[model samples]
Target chain A: MKNRKIRGAYTQYKDNQVTPEDSYWNRRDFIKNLGLSGLAAGSMSSSALMATIDRPVNSGFNTAEPLSTENVVTHYNNFYEFSTSKRKPAEMAVNFKPGNDWKVEISGEIEKPGNYTLEDILSWTRVEERIYRLRCVEAWSMVVPWQGFQLSQLINLVKPTSKAKFVAFETLESRSVFPGQKRGVLGFHVLPWPYREGLRMDEAMNPLAFLATGVYGKPLPGQNGAPLRLVVPWKYGFKSIKSIVKIRFVEQQPYNTWRKSGPREYGFYANVNPKVDHPRWSQATERRITDDSFFGTKRIDTKMFNGYGEQVASLYSGMDLARDF
Target chain B: MSYLVYAAIFRLLGADPQEEMLHQLGLWTLILLLSGLSLTPLNRIFSIPKLIQYRRMLGLYAFFYLVLHILVFFWFYLDANLAELFDEVIKRPYVTLGMLATLLMLPLVLTSTRAMQRKLGKRWKKLHQLVYLIAILGCIHFIWQSKSDLNEPLIYFIWLVSLFSIRAYFARKKAQ
Candidate 1:
C-alpha cells in the first residue's frame, strides 16, 4: 500500500514532488518538465529517459553544474544570424530546417579536403554528451549539456598538413532563410556575411574542442545552431561558431567575425579571461542564467579560463592574455 | 516603462529578462529625452505651439525611467553593492559617462515645477539650457557603452546633433 502510494509519508504530495532527489535532479527535472511532446516517456525507464528512445552507448564527459532548463536553453539564444533579439530566433526559425543533405566542405591545408554529407560526417566521429559552461563576452553564462564529439577526431580524420597553422569555421550563408542577413536595420548588414570564427592549430586539436550536433539529448533546434556547431568550452561562446558550412585549415590567423567588427573589444584569442575586460564592460563576473526569479540569480565571479584552466591554461603558455584580448 | 517590468516578471521578456529590461529602460530614457528635446522644434516646424506644453511631462517621465534603470542595475546586477557600483562608475569610462549624465539631471528635475519656473523667469531658460549638454552627454554615454552595435548609438548621435543645430539656429535668431 505504501509502495503504491508513491510518497509513503507525504501522501498529499505528487510523485514528482516526492521523488527522492539523486544528484541527477537537474536532468531528472529536465526530462520530467521538458514541456515538449517527449513527456510521453513518463512510462519509460529513467536511464532511457535521458535519450528518450534510442539508448545508445554514450560514455560522455560529465559536469557538476546544474544544466539550464530546456525552456531557457531552447528559447533564449544569441543567434544573431536568425534575429538580433534573443527571444525572436526560436519563433523566426520555427520553420528553418537545415535539411538532411547538408554538406560540410573541408578546404585549405587538409590532406583529405572534400565536401562530406552530414550523415557521412556523423559516421566518422563519435557523439557523446558534454555538459559545458558556455560563457558569453556579455558577462553571462549557461551550463548546457551538448551531444558531440571531439573536434580533434575530425581534424585527425581530415589530416591537416604541416603548413596548416589555423582552422577557420564559417556559418551557412542563406540570406533568404536568415532575415538578419537579408535586411539588417535600415538595410545595413548588422554584421558581415558568412559569419566566421577561427582557432589556432593547438586550440583546434585540444580534447575540449567539440562539434555539437545535439543539445539536451535531442537534435538541436535551428535557433540553437542546428546541423553542427563548434563548442570551445574555455573560450567565450562567440568562439563556438554555429551552423557551420566550411572548415578551412589555413596557414594564417583567420579573420573572425567579431574581431573584424569590433577589434578593440573582441579579439581572436577570446579565451574566457576574467582579467581581460571587454572595452565596454567588465568580465570580472558573469550572471549564471539558471532557475531564478527576474532579479534573483546572483552573478558569480568570472573564473580564470572559465574554471577549465587545468585542462587548457598550458595551451596559452606565457602569452599576455590582456594584449591578445 | 512598467510594461518592461511586467514583461520581465511574467517571463515574457525571454531569457536574461533582467538584462533585456535594463537595456529597454535605458533605451526608453534616451527616446524620451530626445522626444522632450524635439518638442520646441516640432512646434516651430509644424507651427503647432501646443506641443511645447508636454515637454515638462516628457522630461519627468524620462527622469522616472532613468531612476528605474539605475534601481534595476543596483538591484539585479550589483545586488545593491554600493562599493561595487561606485567602482564601476569610477573605473569604467562608459559607466562613468552614464553616471555623470544621470547626476546632472538632479538639478533639472528639482527645478522643473511651475512655481520654480515662474520664480526664475529668464534665468529658467538659461539654467534649462543645461539640457543641451545633458543630451550630448546622454548620447555619448549610450554610444560609448555599445559593445559592438554602433548603429543604434550613431543614430542617437545624429538625432542629438540635429537637435543641437536647430536649437542653436533658434537661439541665434532670437539674439539677432
Candidate 2:
C-alpha cells in the first residue's frame, strides 16, 4: 500500500449502495429532521442546517474489505460531548451547530500562533480519503473512510519551534451544545470538559497523522465531531480527540483527558498494541463492526499498531510499549 | 425476554447487537440475583414472612438469565469458539470468577426441587447459604471487569456490602 497513485478523481458516492436495513437509519434521520426543522424555525435557515449529512464519496484509498456503512458510521458514535452511549449522540447533538465561525486556536511554541477558521486552516493542504481501521480501546473496531489532510501540512504551515515537544488538541466546551458536558456520562461526571488529547511532536508530524474534516465524504455532522477532529490511525480511538477547537504546540507533556482522568489505564502514547492488553479488557482481538445480516459482528485477531506498524513503529523503536501502555 | 429477540429480528439492536444482548442478560441476572438475596433480609426487617416464599423463584429466574448470558457469549461473542471461551475463562481473572460462580450455582439449582429439599433437610439450608459466597464472587467479578468509570460497578458493590452488613446485624441480634 506504498504510494499507490489515485486512479479516479471524482466517483460520486451513489447513495444507492445502502442495504434494505437502511430503513432504520432513515427512521432515525426522519426523527432528526423533525428536530432540525424545529431548530430552523427557531434560529437558522433549513438550508444552512443538514437534514441528512450526505456528501459525495471521494475515491482515494482502496481496501478489499468492506467499509462500514455511512449511516452506521455516523449514527453509531463515541462522542462523550453529546452522550457516552454510542447511539444517543446522533439524536442528542441535533441542535449542536459548530457555528459559521468555528475557530481553531494555534498556540504555544508555534511561530505563527493565531485563531484561524477551519476553512482557513484547510486552505494549507488538500483533503484526501484515507480508509483506515479505527480500533477503539473498548476492543471494538471500524474501518472508516475519512476525508482529511495530513497534520504535517498544518504543522509545516504553522512552523513549530524547537521548544515544541508535544502538540495538544482540545475539543469545543460549550455546554449548551454538548448536553453531556452540561450533565454527565450516565450520571457519572468524571472527565473535565473540553476533552484534551496530545501527541509527541514527532508523532504529530507522522505521515499517518490526520485532521479529519469529514467522514463518508459529507462535512462532519455534530454527532461525529462536526467541523474538525483528529484521526491518528496507530493510536487508540481516544487519542484521536473529537470536535477540536484548539491546537497547541507545547513544550511539556500536555494535559490529555484520559491520562488525567485515568492515569493507570490511559497513557499518553496510546499506540494500538494487542500485546499490551487494557486493564479492563484484552486487546488481543477486536470485534470488527460489520452490518452483517444477522448483526453478527466478526471477532478478529488484533494486530500490532492496529495493522499500521510498518508505517508508525519507528516512532517507538527502543521504548517499552508494554510499560508505556 | 421476547422484546430483546424481537429487537434483534427487526434489526433495531443498534451497532453491536451481541454486545447489547450480553449486557442486557448480565444486567437482568445481577438484578434478579440481588432481588432474591434481598428477600430474606426484607422478611426479617419488615416481619413479612410471606416474602420468603418468592426467594426460590427469584433465584431460578436469575439462573435462567445467567444461562442466556452464557449462551449469548459462546454463540455470538466467541462464535462457538470453545477454545477461545476456555482461554478467556483461564486467562482473565474476572472471567474466572464469573465462571466459578456459574459452576457453583449448578449444585444449588439441582437440589432446588421439593423432594430434594425434603431429603436434604438441614443440609439443604447449609448448602443454600453458599449463595452468600456466590453473591460475593459475582460482586467481585462485576467490579474487576469494570474499565475505568467504576460508577455502575461501585453502586452494585456498595449495595452488596450494605446487604451483607444488614445480615451481619441480624446475626449479632440473634446471638444476643
Candidate 3:
C-alpha cells in the first residue's frame, strides 16, 4: 500500500514536470495553455493557488474524512446577507456583484490605517491551505479546505497600537444587491444589516484565526463571501463574518449583529461549546450535512472547541464560556 | 388536499425532502386541528347544522397527520433509533410537548366511534374537550422548537387564542 501511494505521487510529480523553477513558470504557462485571456488567467491562477498548496494533515486537526464535495458546500450556506433559507443564498446571490476591485478599510487604534485593495492585501503575505471543520450555530457542520493566510499576519502589518485590545470586522451591506438588507416585503429583519463580528486581541492573533480568500481551490462563490472572509474554527460559524469590508482595532468589544438582534440567543463570543445550549436548541450534537440520502444526514457528537481544544482551550481558561456565550 | 400537493412538490424538488416533509406535515396537523375547532363557531355563525358533519372528519385527519409527523421524526430524524427517540423526548422540552400532544390525541381517537360515544353519553363531551388542551400543547411545541423567526408560530398562537376567545364568549352567553 505504501509503495503504491509513493509510486502514485512520483507519477503525479513526473506528469506535472515539477522542478525548483517550475513554481514560477507553471502558473503562467498553465493558464496560457488553457487559452484564457490575460484578465481571466489572473483571476483563475489566484483561485487555483489553493489547489497548488500542500495539504498534509497537520497535527491537532482531523483529516480522516474526505473533504465535503464543492457542490454540497457551495449550495448549502447560511449567508443571511442574501436570504434566510440555506438554499436561497446560492440562488439569490447571483444578483450580488463582489467587485474585483475590492478595497478593505483598516482603521481605529492602528498605527498604519488605510484602504487596501485585495491585490495589495494578497501581496502582504503568503497564502496557505488549511482543512478546518466549520460548525454552524444551527447545529450543522462541514469540513472545508480553506485558502488564506493567518489573520495575525495582516494584523501585524497594520501594527495595532498597544491600546487595541479587540478586533472588530464589518461586512459589505448593499440594499440594492443584498435582498435581505432591503426594507420591504421581500426583506428579512431577523438580523441587523451589515453584519459585524469581533474577537479578543489574543484570539484574533491566534494561528488558527484565518482570513480565507478561496475555498475548494477556487475564488469564493458570491454566496460564500467572495474576495475575503474570517475563519475562526473553534467559534460558531457566525463569528466568521463574510465579505469583510472593515477591520477595526478597538479597546472595547464590538457589538456583533446576532447579539444585537437577539441578545438572549446569540452571544458575542459564540464559541462551539456543547455544554452551552442555545435558548431553543441543544448544542451537544450536530447533523454533519453531506449529500442527502435515504438514511438522512449523520449526527455526531459535537466536540469542545470543535476538536481544536488542544490548540485553543487555554485562551478562555479563566472566563465562563456559558456566560460569554 | 393542498397539504398533500405541497408534500408531493416538496418530495419532488426539495433540497432536504425529509425536513420539508416533517415541517409540512406538522403544519398541516396544526391547521387541521384548528379547523376542527372552528367548525362549531362557523356552524353557529351560519346557523347551519350541516357543517357539524365535517367536525369528526377534520379531527381524525388532524390526528392522522400528527401521527405521520411523529413517525417521520422518528424514522427520518432519529433513523428509528428508539433509544435516541426516548432520550430526545426526555432531554428536549419541545420534543416532550410534541409527544405529549400525540399521546393526548390517542384517547380522543379511541372514543371517536359512534358506539363508544353512545356508551359514554354525556361523559363523552367532557372527554372530547381534551382537543383544546391538545391544540395548546401543539402550538407550544411549534413555538418552542423555533430557534428564531417566530412569525409562523406567532400566527398559530394568535389563531388558537382567537378560537378560544370566541368559544369562551359563547360559553358565557349560554351560561346566562
Candidate 4:
C-alpha cells in the first residue's frame, strides 16, 4: 500500500504539477480536506478535470521572459477562416463549435494510417507546455505558451515510409461554420479554401515542431484552432496551419495556401528570414504586439529564424534563406 | 461629415483605432478627390453651373484628409521618425507613389486660391488638370499597397476608369 501511494504521487507529479515543496504540501492538504466526493465531482467532466490542471507545465522550453497575458493571446488572432481582420476571429469564433468528437485523419505513406479521435491521440502522447515566439509575415509577433505534444511523437506512431518526403496539413472546411468561405461580390478572394500547409519530412520531425491543442491551461478556443493545430516556430506564422483535420505524408512538396494565394509575396518555405522583404512591406523589423504603449508597439530587429537559430539554422545549411523565402 | 461620425463609432468600439483611422482617412481622401473631379462632368451633364462651386471645397477637404492620413501613418507606424519615413519614401514603391500623389496635389492646393486662379488665367485650367493624374496615382498607390484583397481597390480603379472615359468623350466632342 505504501509503494502504491508513492507511485500515485509520482504519477501525479508527471501530470504537470511542478510546484515546490511548500505549495505542493498546501495543495495536498486542500485535496485531502476536499475528500472523495469533491474529487469525483472535479473528474466528472474532461473540461472540469482540465480546469484543475495547472496553467502550463514548466516544460523548460519557456523563454526567460514572462508570457503574454492570456487576454491578449486569446483576443488577438489571425484565423482568416472567420474573417481577415485580427479581431474578427475572436468575435465570430464564439459561435463556432469545435465539438467534443473531433477526429484527425492521418494517411499517406504511413504504416498505421487511420482516423484517430482527439482522445486517442491525447492518450498516445505526452503533452507539455512550450512557449514559442510567433512571428507573422506581416511584421508583427507575439510570445505564446502553447500546450501540446511534439509533432515527432505523432509522426513516430504512424511510422513513415522511406517514400514519405513531405508532410501536408489541411484545415477543416465548413461553410456553415466559416463565414469567410462564403462567396460575395464585395468580399475579398484572397485565400482559397480549405487552408493547406506542408513541411519537409525532416522539419516535421524537428523537436520544435508542435501539434497544439490547448493554451492558458484549457482546451483551445475555436478562434485559436481548437482540437489540433501545427506550430512550426522557425517558420512564419502562416505556415503553422490551424484547425487541422488532415495530415498526409507525401513524396513531393505540397502546395501551401499562402504561397498559392500570393506566390510573389509568400514563399513555400516561409522561414522567418529578415533579408527578404515582402513586395508591400519591409521584414527587417517586427512590432512586438505584446508591448503596447501610448507611443506605439515596440519595434525590434527581426532575428534570423525568429531567434531559434541555434536549433534551426543548421537545417538550412546549404540553402540560401533569402532565395527560399 | 458622415466620415466624422464613422470615425467616432470606430473609436468607441475600441478597435485598432490607428489602423481604422488611417484607412478611413485615406478612403475619404480618395472619395472626395473623385467627387471633386466629377463636379465638372455633373455640371455639364445636368446643366447646373452652380454645382461647380463645391469643387474647391471638396478638393481642399480631400487634401485635408490626405494630410491627416500621412500624419497618422507617421505617428503610429514610424513613431514620427523623420529619417525612417524618408527611408520608406525612398525604398518603398507604394510609398513613393503615395507621396508623389500627395506632392502633386501641393501645387494645385496652393493655386486653388481665387487670387492665384485669376492671376494664372488659361494656365490655371491646364495646371488644375493635374487632378486627373493625381486621381490615377492615388488609385495606383492604393492598389499597389494591397497585399491581397484587391476588391476595394479594384472598385476604385473601375470608378476612375469610367470617370476618365466620360471626360474623354466630352473632350472629343468639344474638339469636334
> Which candidate ranks first by lDDT, i.e. highest?
1
Tell me each candidate's i-RMS in Å: 2.2, 3.1, 4.1, 4.1
**Model 1 per-residue lDDT tens digits across residues A175-217:** 7778778654545677898899999999999888999877766
The lowest-lDDT stretch of 10 consecutive residues in candidate 2 chain A is A51-60
Candidate 4 per-residue lDDT over residues B13-129, each given as its tens digit:
223445556777898999999999888888878889998999999999999999999998888777688998998999889899999999999999999999999999999999998
Clashing pairs in 3: none
- For candidate 1 chain A, which ten residues in a row score worst on lDDT? A1-10
Question: Which number leads on TM-score?
Answer: 1
Candidate 3 per-residue C-alpha lDDT over A1-325 given as tens digits, one digit per residue, 9 for 90 to 100: 1221222101212222222223324543564455454544445543343344333334433343445556667877788778766778888877555543579999999999999977667767766666789899988787776777799999999999999999999999887668766543423365678899999999999889999877766667788887789999999999999999999999999989889888998998888999998866678888776554433367788999998887888999999888988
lDDT of 3: 0.78
Native contacts kept (model 1): 0.42
In model 1, which residue pairs have backbone atoms overlapping below 3 Å?
A: none
Off by over 4 Å in 3: A1-53, A59-62, A182-188, A261-264, B1-18, B46-50, B75-87, B168-176
> Comparing candidate 2 with candidate 3, which one achieves the higher DockQ?
2
**Per-model TM values vs. the true structure:** 0.86, 0.83, 0.79, 0.82
How many pairs in model 2 have backbone atoms within 3 A of each other, for residues 3 or more apart or on separate chains, i.e. clashes? 0
lDDT of 2 by residue, B1-176 (tens): 79888888987778878777888888788888999999888988999999988989999988999999999888866768899899889888988998999999999999999899999999999999898888888888887876544667777777888889899999999999
Cα lDDT for residue A293, candidate 1:
54
- Name the runs in model 1 displaced over 4 angstroms: A1-60, B168-176
Best model number under DockQ: 1
Query: What are the Cα lDDT values of the candidates?
Result: 0.80, 0.79, 0.78, 0.78
